[model samples]
Target: MKTFLFRSIIGIFFGAFLAVLFTNAIVIFEGRETLDGALFIKNSIGSILCGWFSAVSPLYFEIPSLKLSQQTALHFVTLFILYFLLAFGIGWIPFTWNSFFITVLIFIVFYLIIWTCFYLYFRQQAKKLNAELTNLQR
Candidate 1:
């Protein structure tokens, strides 16, 4: 729990940085500007909280007795729900059907990228371990 809290706090800073960077980029490219410093501060705080929750929520998943595929699907479903609720709740995006679809799609892509990286890393580790075991047996 302590480590999780620390991770969440770190995620807050990361999320805030990404939020500011993207906001500035949008303003530059899209001509859509924030009205004031206060709005920007509010957005920063909202994004920070959203990041904190997103980073920490996965710790609570406890589905057992399922195959890895089933567990992974459930894990993604949980993430989609968490991202959707938190994003909509924070006013980070609008509440239209189009907005919902776009947000969900983005969330799914984010998770897929993360999972793929982890999968590749672990697969490499497993291959190394198997080769080591083969050498040991020989």
Candidate 2:
């Protein structure tokens, strides 16, 4: 429970940070004259909620399995649903087949990038631990 809440809070802040940065960039790029304060507020809240909901998958491990692929699948599925809701429910993306398809492609690309980073981080940590154990044995 504590882990879940902690992770969720972290997600909330991180998501909001990214939201601000991305939205602002888009606004600037599009040459928008003025920012809609209400829209920004609504979108930020939605993003925070998105983070809260999506963070559960990474911190959750009730299955007691050792299969990395299975764990990754579960995580991806959970995130897919969460992101779909965030996009379609919050009007972040249009309600069209083309939009949905593009959203899915974006999700896949980001998921793979994030997963690869995590995998590399874990591998590095494991290597460090193995080295430490080897040194202790000597």
Candidate 3:
């Protein structure tokens, strides 16, 4: 519980940071000085929630009965729902079918990319541990 709380706090900060960074970039690109207070607050809150969920979503994998595939699918679906609803509510994406479809595509692409990177990294770590174990047995 303590570890979870610590991670949640970190996630909230990280999420807020990313929200500010992205908002700033958009403002600059659009030749605007700043976002309005309400929009800023909404985005901040949404980002924080998203971040918190992202950090804790890995707990799904801790279920011993769940296969890796099941864990991954569940995580992906929940995250997709959370992000899609938040993004739509925060006005990050337009309220149109086309916009929603495009956003979904983008989300899937990024999610797969990140998932693949982590998978490869952990797979490499597992291989290294196996090698070390073999060396120890020799």
In angstroms, give how far residue 61 of model 2 lies from its true place.
5.6
The CA lDDT of each predicted structure is: 0.76, 0.83, 0.89
How many backbone clashes can be found in candidate 2?
0
Residue-level lDDT of model 3, residues 1-138, one tens digit each, is: 887888899889989998889888888899987668887888889988889889878778778999999999999998988888888888889999999999899999999999999889999999999999999999
Q: Each model's TM-score?
A: 0.67, 0.81, 0.88
The most accurate candidate by lDDT is 3
Candidate 2: 10-residue stretch with minimal lDDT: 59-68
lDDT of 2 by residue, 1-138 (tens): 888778888888887987888788978999887888888888888888886777767853356764777888878888788778777888999999998999899889998998899899989999999999999999
Residue pairs in candidate 2 whose N, alpha carbon or C atoms collide under 3 angstroms: none
> After TM-score superposition, what is the CA distance of residue 108 in candidate 3 from its true location, in Å?
1.0
TM-score-better candidate, 1 vs 2: 2
- Model 3 CA lDDT for position 10: 85
Rank the models by TM-score, top first. Answer: 3, 2, 1
Stretches off by above 4 angstroms in model 1 are: 23-35, 58-67, 136-138
Summarize candidate 1's per-residue lDDT along 41-138 as a digit string, tens digits: 77787777767766765554444667667767876877677667766876777999998888777877888898888779989999999999999999
Best candidate, TM-score? 3
